[model samples]
Target: MPFIPHTDEDITGMLDVIGVDSIDALFDEIPKELRAKELAGVPSGLSEMEVTQLLQARARIDGEPTCFIGAGAYDHHIPAAVWQITTRGEFYSAYTPYQAEASQGTLQVLYEFQSMMTALTGLDVSNASLYDGASALAEAVLMAVRANRKVKTTRVLMPRSVHPFYRRTVRSIVQHQGIDLVEVDFDTETGQTTLAHCETAGDEPFAALVVPQPNVFGVLEDVNALTDWAQSRDALVIGVVNPVALALLSPPGDWGQNGADIACGEGQPLGMPLASGGPYLGFLCCQQAFIRQLPGRIAGKTEDVDGKVGYTLTLQAREQHIRRSKATSNICTNQGLLVTAATVHMAILGAEGLERVAAACLANTDRLAQQLCEVPGVEPIFEAPAFHERALRLPAPTEDVLAALAEQDILGGFDLGREYPELGCALLVCATERRTDAEIAAYREALASTLAIAEAA
Candidate 1:
């Protein structure tokens, strides 16, 4: 939708209500030198039809390729009904569920979203949602630090296998608070941060250990042993999981001897489409022990004096335009539309259908990996198992190989060298249920030819 700026009369009315004679008076506190004298490089206004045409032309230049990349955002099959229901005004235009007495429908939608996430993570409770996977993870780490009263250590031991973007976001968020992030390297052969890395991290004063399932390289970690290692040190184990894999793998709540303390991950694969980057969903869940420190709002089911079922904003630790020092998190609202879409998608798929989808994703990915690895100079990098995404050692620098693949109209995969310099000439590729056998075969053939040509050159 095109933006509609305020009319002159409306603006004058707002300024009058604010006791300001002119719009320029609004920013009087800012130094004159700091403010722009005039808007620089601002585009001239265009008609709605002209703006639409301009965007469509640019989009055409950004041709759609058969995507095989799943660095974080995934391309998945979203049931049509998911969006058809979510786009309804009741959900699409709903405000924050703050008025406990009124927002029963919105609150119930969140209640269901939380319930599904908790069930998927096997944790006792869940929040409505967070900003995104990265922020959710940063919040999870902060939660562990606050909850770990006995732990004297301010360090957080995380594996290099965690998504690089998420790791950077966590560091940026927590470093200001004096939290130290110690990165653990992967086992060269397995591409996993094995239990042995934990041992090497030693019995430090660490507050939390983040264990990413089917980590950044798409190699599944030995989470049970890793979880036990963190637990043994009296540090909290924060599991960063992939929701789809939770259907096939052991959930974090059942990870080790006692299981992970907190679980969080990206919820894009649930029902969200890869819309360039996103408007994605973030899911955070954990045991009842640390529910108070949960960074976002949560919903609870209750009955009133009339014995009628109801929903309400059970907990909101955010400062709410109030004090920040005592606030658990600054985030005030949930991703309501995205959460609604996920909830509806999950409901339509059910447990059996979700499991089947996961199974298909695994099988399709495995087949693609097998075919690709069969190509000369192409091999799986990790010995550990993977789900939809996996790392492959390429015969040449990943960028060149990907460029060649693009010429064949394939999106190819993520080049690991940019972030993981040690993983020389490696590519992280994913194949969801949306991938057909023909597409996988095409990727394999294109990749093989690309490598052969690059090697010859």
Candidate 2:
């Protein structure tokens, strides 16, 4: 743990052992112009004490807001008890439970986490965790392809309204594997994934269909009908869902009961911080039919020789440690700490409490949407009811309105026009349980004034 700089002798010995003369020779393939002369803007060196103070000072330049800005990563009220419990030394700096016999506590927590995720998603089984929601979805897609071995066409149909990041993540994962990626468009009025478009796209011999519940636009999909449509064609249906929405909305496992193969989503809103976007948990769950295709390690309950109940890693086919390159997925590590935080948060806020949280968030979002609609230039873009997020069309350009709102230290909604040109002046705004009545009023007032200026300009 002590800092010791490598001496000339040490470098010489290492280089000689590797048959290399100089460090620069290691980058023979890198273009000369691309190589930095001296890390141009950075200072060469600083004393340890100076570096510490510099880092502290730089960190003091906080970019975080004191108020609401919930999109994907929310601003929920994390209980102090969560911090108190998760910070315990036994759990805080723990590593993976590779040695099953030695890591009983670690494995037990993971088992509990898996059980909680199963309950949340309404799936029969759940994996320990994945890196994040996007990766989980990518893994699910890969799993579907693997399950549909008889299918000649390796195609996955995703919705255009699925989180743009999730879509990109799926594409990135499948592109190299030679799977066809089909993105279903939205019904312009509902802002929901179009089943008509899916019917058109689903004609091809496809491996699976990926749909999100309370999708990117926050419009809930008809999971039953969608799952039926996919299964009728003998294709796997994967739903990327919001766990909070699942409290009020139908669970994807319910879709599995109606016939879906996989369910996955980012578990951030359950109890993780925005932390400028992550260190969040990725939840993947499914019925026993496709359990073999589940990507991450699974924690299953069992009885020891003493006849006492215990937990251990089970059905771990996707991990590299078990199967190497031929594995279903290569996610070596799960989001353990984040998953533990969520498990604790969920335990404290039981079923009724979780539903109450969801209801409060939905109520706040509805109220905010109604208030914002009063602004002359602002109008709700979709007719369908959303859970805790919505898309609104500004009478003026989104950039102008956002810039004006930002001047008041209010982070406005994400601009949809940036990604979908035909969406015109639409902005995607989200509100959660954390946004107070006063803050919602403030955001409305700010948007009203900002919109007036935008329209005039």
Candidate 3:
């Protein structure tokens, strides 16, 4: 796509067709008070070569590091074919399938994506995809509150063990709708949410509870007990999980009692890359009973008039299908490209391959944690078993230690002190199957040497 300069006459013709006086007039629909006048300090223009040079310089500022950081987004190894086929003109340039019949290929891709997500989460239904994991969990909270027939209250329980960013995102979303997010603390030693915390939460009229499996510290929670407890109180249990971890742990749909009502999580582990924060998508799934409350779009398969197999968009729960006030979510656009990549990734790695990948991740993580803890100043903060990430207490400030490692071009881990103040100097590290033994060794050596330097200073 080459850029073509629009002539004055072309602009005038376009404005005339739209009954607008100028390009600025087209933005009249947006409130003038809310509009930004301009990007302050931005340069007017530059030659293509000059702009390219500027961008290249900016990109060089971030040094390449052997990434051990996995707070949420992971550095998993993506197959070469995954992106090769995904970027093909057909999938790359695709748009929303407004007319399902005409968009059979796109619809089928989404249908397969939804089917894979459902199988992964052990739920009856799954929407195509959501913006990201944080927003997806927020949407799940909304869905649970709306579908809860047992309670009229919007008070929801969120675990402290869940990712801090996710908790904050949920608060921002549901607070305006009269949803009260109650914090449930985790055991300091085990890094797991104790049932005692919820038991003490009292008989408040709550509608939903979020359970994060293998939480931020990577310690697995007691899913069965947590789910059963929420069900006993007539509150819907929403599981915030890792898609890869689901291959090894019990799926949300089999939690306890009647099982969790909704399961949502970051799908980056499935196929998407970190891409420096994200271009990653979220997956949302639920039991059949709450299928109508599922946000975004769902695709269904059927036979057409000619008896040929076909796929079509089905049960759209967005504002486009119904009144805005009654819609499940207004933010309901599927991550079509990322989902296509994910769908292809899943197809390539079937059930057995997925389990093997997950098992390998566990093995690598265990090995890394064991080696790192051998450093004098480092010790595993949590006694419980964690999948791929573990919190370690460092003798020095985590940021200082991380900075030293960064100098050597090794991305150590997440500084947990920022999110978990109680655990000072805590470092949360993870190692996926993508991390080779040599890379793990390098990280260990860097951290040990960095800590030694800090102590000497």
Q: Per-residue lDDT of 1-457 in model 2, one digit per residue for the tens?
A: 1376888899899899989999788898899889876677876677889999999988787654434455567778887888688878877887887667667787898998888878877778888889889988998988888887557567889888888888888888778898788878989888877669798784677888898888888888777888888887778888898887788887777773475668898899778877777889888998777788778887777878999888788776657887999887877888888878888898999888889989999998899888999988688888887888888888888888787888787888787888888889988887788888888899999988877766667
Each model's lDDT: 0.88, 0.82, 0.88
Residue 393, model 1: Cα distance from true site in angstroms? 0.9
Name the lDDT of candidate 1: 0.88
Specify the poorest-scoring 10-residue window by lDDT in model 3.
Answer: 315-324
Estimated TM-score for each candidate: 0.91, 0.88, 0.90
In terms of lDDT, the best-performing candidate is 3
- Candidate 3 residue 397 Cα shift, in angstroms, is 0.6
Off by over 4 Å in 3: 5-57
Clashing pairs in 2: 256-260
| Model 2 residue 268 distance off true place after TM-score fit, in angstroms | 0.5
lDDT for each residue of candidate 1 in 1-457, tens digit (9 for 90 to 100): 2486889889999999999999899899999899877677897789989999999999899787899999898888999999999999977887987776778878899999998988889999999998889889999998898888778777899899999999999988887888888888889798889777766776667999999998998888989998987888889999998888888889999999998999999999889989877788788998998988888878889887899999988755454545466888878887889999999999999878888888988898899889999999989888888878889998898998888899888999999989988878889998988899999999988988888878788
| Best-to-worst ranking by lDDT | 3, 1, 2
Question: Of models 2 and 3, which has the larger TM-score?
Answer: 3
Q: Poorest 10 consecutive residues of model 1 by lDDT?
A: 315-324
